[model samples]
Target: MISMNCFELFIQTYFTQLQVLDISRACAGEYINGFRWEQLISTSIQHLRIFALQISFKTNDPLMRENTIQQFQSPFWQEKQWFFICSSYSIMFDSYINLYSINPYRKKYYLLGNENTTEIDSMPFVVQLDIQCENV
Candidate 1:
């Protein structure tokens, strides 16, 4: 059984990987100084069965948002079973949140949402993925 702390660590690592991918994709056309992390992930972490990607951008411009969406929907990455979660609020302020997951062999994305937002002061979103491998 995975401990609570270990699970938290796993989530953090997943978030980090997603951030790196987003940054790389956004700057793909530009002359970047660093190598892509996707190559490293493909070489290492062979046992990884699930990937979660989350992208957050703080901007009021519509064109920037469109560009960000385009980068995420690019075909440079292989196609796999994907799960996407999106939430946005445009009331007093504007905010958008999205999370994505890919798993080759199983459905793993989990959704947890709160029932009441009246008492809460902010929007909350959750995406969870479970991955397990069995030896044949």
Candidate 2:
């Protein structure tokens, strides 16, 4: 299991030559913030052109989640033609929101409301992006 800093370091250290990247996973805090990702990409991966990722953020606060998702609407994302499709649902005490890039390598399949159901063939790593959430 890689910590957030370690994951960032891995990308910074080894993926500097990276032209494309595709990742999907549950995330929180800074990982869910688009501005932080923009900063990281700007400072670390100079050659990065195609970035496809689905960052799922879970919280009890809907307003905070909405605000966080707004960070992706900036020019840094738009100028790169990095549009996104977001999906949300509530599971017991937590509200889950997924922000995924809609690009050429964009995700086409989504599995919501069940985090434990991972054996499906449509999982994102091979198919591209998997935005999963817990059951409502």
Candidate 3:
């Protein structure tokens, strides 16, 4: 298992090189324990997409998921884009399946709620962005 500091270093060093990073099979315990939202906003990579699946281990209580969702929906991140996918099983486990994206000139956010009952698929949950950039 990668230590928290190492994970932070890895993200800092490598996230810029990646256009998309998928960690669908990995558990959330490692990430939630070490991840700070502030750290993500500070990355040098101005554009990236992160897909995390089966990561509900952070939501131990009924309110936890809602709180996290609230943070995701917060307008404070008007410059960033985020997507979320919460599985029924993960709702019980408190693991979250979500995506984070960053772009300087455009933003998109998607929310997948508790309505879908399909079994988790091997395909990584992804949000396709159709951005039309305009020159400033």
Candidate 4:
């Protein structure tokens, strides 16, 4: 098994060729801050892949989520496989509200103009933007 840092590196280097990748605790705190990361992977003695990256704090912040989505939803990232997982409890709360409101019985009582409800509806757009950024 490789160390966390090295695993992150390997993912970056060979992400395109990889059919599967699992990462944990590699980018915890630093995930919110901008940083550079690299990865190298070898599929065989003669086959190697390398990827170098400078991560931007462009999409991780809640305040900038809408803007980030607008920027990344362009024609870029159309062909890459990407995933993003957010640990923000507040976002999860918003998602829960969204789900609750979606129930036919609940929708009748919830105010149509509620801000939190609106934000919950917008979460999928925000997530799609993050994915586009990673893939792009």
Candidate 5:
């Protein structure tokens, strides 16, 4: 499992020469705010054209949930055309909020969970879409 700091370092260290980046496995409890914590991305990954990352955080705080979407509303990421979507799901005791990019560098697979989800941009070629919902 890679921490957010490690992901940041990975990008800073190697993304300069890469064009696309994707992290398949979920990053446990790593919260990312593009507005407050992504200055390094625009500057560091000069050659990065597409970035696909999924970050998860365990929380039920409304502010944290809102920030998951609010933080990515900045032009800092939009201008680069890197967009993301935030999802909030409550599975029993734990509430998991995930933030992931929807960049169109490859085949698109979008998943919408049972809880609330917010997306910054839309993907045209959605090969797969999954939605899960259950009454609590």
Candidate 6:
């Protein structure tokens, strides 16, 4: 599990590129590296509400399967957008992502593999997330 301090630093660093309001916390000219951590977190929270993320992981190995689910449920991944890009600094996971949803009460996950297919294929030992939640 990632410690709170680590998570905070992760958030701070990940959001350093964000374009904040041109006010007291702006990082560029007329500002003094004034970006604040709270602002970065707020931006991330907003992104969570508005964006759909594409996440992928291999699960051929039993141990990896367990890790995938655990990572999915971690605090860093609770936000859907982060989960889509959290595995590695790779862009391939962003391809061919189709929106999907889950039923928490049923503990069931649904995937859209191909638009023309009617049958559910056997689990391919790979999990991909293209989840989209309504902005609230």
Question: Best candidate, TM-score-wise?
Answer: 2
Q: How accurate is candidate 3 locally (lDDT)?
A: 0.41
Compute each candidate's TM-score over C-alphas.
0.34, 0.70, 0.46, 0.24, 0.63, 0.23
| Candidate 4: pairs in clash | 9-39, 13-51
Candidate 1: regions farther than 4 A off: 1-40, 43-47, 55-57, 83-87, 102-136
Question: 18-124 in candidate 4: lDDT tens per residue?
Answer: 32222212223333221222112222111212111222332244644343333323332122222222222344334210000011111112122212333332221
Task: Encode model 3's per-residue lDDT on 1-136: one tens digit a residue.
Answer: 3444665664556344434433323344444421354356456434555433223344455555455545545553444445443332365545444433323233344322234455633322333222121211
Judging by TM-score, tell me the better candidate of 3 and 5: 5
Highest lDDT against the true fold, candidate: 2
- Winner on lDDT between 2 and 6 is 2
Clashes of each: 0, 2, 7, 2, 0, 0
Stretches > 4 Å off in candidate 3: 1-4, 26-35, 49-54, 76-78, 87-136
Worst window of 10 by summed lDDT in candidate 2: 122-131
Clashes of 1: 0
lDDT-sorted candidate list, best first: 2, 5, 3, 1, 6, 4
Candidate 3 residue 123 C-alpha distance from true site, Å: 25
RMSD each, Å: 13.7, 7.7, 12.9, 17.6, 11.0, 18.7
Over 1-136, each residue of candidate 1 has an lDDT whose tens digit, in order, gives 2332453454445433321121101111121211232333344333333445543434455554445444444342344233333333454676543333333233434322233234423222323333332211
Residue by residue across 66-127, what tens digits does model 2's lDDT show? 68658888888888787777778888877888888775564344333344544434322332
**Cα RMSD (Å) between model 1 and the true structure?**
13.7
Return whichever of 1 and 5 wins on TM-score: 5
After superposing candidate 4 on the true structure, give the runs of residues whose Cα lies further than 4 Å from its correct spot. Answer: 1-7, 12-16, 22-62, 67-74, 81-136
Model 2 bad stretches (over 4 Å): 104-136
Better of 5 and 6 by TM-score: 5
